[model samples]
Target: MIRFGVDRLVADPDLLGGAKRVGLVTNDAARMAADPARLARVALREAGVPITRLFGPEHGLNVQSADGVHVDDGIDTMTGLPIISLYGERYCPSPAVMRDLDVVLFDIPNVGARFYTYTWTLYHMMAACTAALVPIIVLDRPNPLGGDLSLAEGPVLDLAVRSFVGEDAIPIRHQLTNGELATLWQREQFAGVRLDVLSCDGWTRAMQWPDLQLPWVPTSPAMPSFESAQLYPGTCLFEATNLSVGRGTDIPFQQIGAPWLDVPAVLSDLARRVPKGVEFSEVTFVTGLAPYAGELCHGIKITVTSASALRPVALGLLLMAAVASTHRLRFQ
Candidate 1:
């Protein structure tokens, strides 16, 4: 029942704004809700939008690359267009990539966490567009985690912890769609670029993805499901440490563990400490990937009982604290 920006754009191809050559910053996850088999690019092209090139974000346009894997630039066999990699070799479009395009369109789905690299990709694109004098259009999608500004979490990034994982002073659980974040960046930083947001209709600050009746699509390897994304704003921090946040495993952010972790003790602590919106269970898993592969580790499989009450940043830090306090030796 909800029409995402792609759907609206297709309904009226004029949204391309009379551009003859266009570049799209997108990934495989961006598909039309009405035609799930067709991607946003295909739909736009069918509707007569002249998309000349593409820009791949963190996971590559295919969305199959491993977490933090370097995606190299290549040609999209399906479209026969050059695909520029923003996650590798460069974090933004080179001036040359911008010169070939008359306009740029962005249509990637976001998991609603500041550390989820795609949001920052938009920031870099905004800066590049500003510098190149190319107007950028963002085909907004729903923030799977909901967009209630009041639910935002912080310990907002400062200069010390900034990196590809996070930057600026953006909060951790920033409850906004990617387009909204783009507008904020333009206002605070890249005001020189002309930014247009084709916002999704029927989406509101109070509605989470589950409420929309749309199928969940994985935009990144780790964020494979709603449950994983539910805990990602916090659990992703485990990657910064020696602990395993279940990557290279089936569950990814849904489960967290380290071989050295004492699951029972950590569980006992989290039982009383974690915030109201979540409930977690003890899980013993062997990751097939990194941090601790082939060896068994014990940790928690977090479940969201009430989305409204969860403070992801608070929950994540508390979980870390619990693990750290219980067994200082394994805490990192």
Candidate 2:
């Protein structure tokens, strides 16, 4: 089993014992010893270390909901700790939120995709902590896609295109873990945050998450399984179009299409149009939540039989073209 930073922290308290009052920034994915809030807090509490507060990322400390959905403020029902929502109303903690903390800890699992927002949330919170002169610690986990050392696809974001989604010029699937990313951000991306990353032990750059024996938790709504995450770097481009990115389905990003789509034909054309590594399966389903709820929608399931040869953003673009060729698609 891969021992993450949180795992190590629980086993050894001397590392972070120097801090007086600590603040933990996490989400629903934070778990340790069978608890949703995870071991970060429990470890600190067990050591008699003062954990002053809790900060939640996109899905809040209890990970739930679909993409772009916001979480509101409330006490963590499990931990009985005050919680702050960073995904809603604010993207970063105010100086006040960091005022009482000697150190801030971040321990969320991140899929290696650049467009995922947790890394950006790290970027923002680190900046805020920097201004407040608080040191930040990131608990590293494996990049599920297996950190194959390859250059990123898609053009680097033009400064004008920069948003929370496109924070840096890194490629769509920039092959780096949260630890390596934090290092790059401190040494290069962000100017002056005091950053410390606790890296994973027994984890190799080429090992995927399933191979690690750690539990699988969906970091975001659309990204559910290894295959869903595998398809995401490419299929996520569907969001830029009028089609639903499987928002209402049980498996999102895996099956993507709209009621107007000619599902099997599109799959056949997409299979021929893309380079290789991706297999398309025709599927029809209805959304349980979003647009076209209770209505059957035809779409194709994207499967990555081979990660080495698949180009996600390129395939996503081709899929968009296929959808556009048949309908007057607009980004909504």
**Tens-place lDDT digits, model 1, residues 1-332:** 78888899999988776899999999889999787778888888889999999999988999998778889999987788889999999998899889868899999999988888898888899989999999999999889889888988877888786888786688888888888888888899988999999898888889988998878888888777887888888888878888888887778887888878888888888778746788888888997888788999887888888889987778888988888899886576
Candidate 2: worst-modelled 10 consecutive residues by lDDT: 31-40
Score candidate 2 by TM-score against the native: 0.90
- lDDT at 163 for candidate 1? 86
Clash count list over all predictions? 0, 3
Q: What is candidate 2's CA lDDT for residue 314?
A: 81
- Candidate 2 per-residue lDDT, tens place, 1-332, comes to 56778777777766785888888888766566224345556655775656778888886676775567787877977567898888898998888888888898888878777788887888888788878988888877778877777636776668778888878778888878887888887888566778888888888877876687666776766666777787788787777665767876778887786777777666666666765787778888888756667778888877777777777778888887766665554324
Error (Å) of candidate 2 at residue 99 is: 1.7
Off by over 4 Å in 1: none
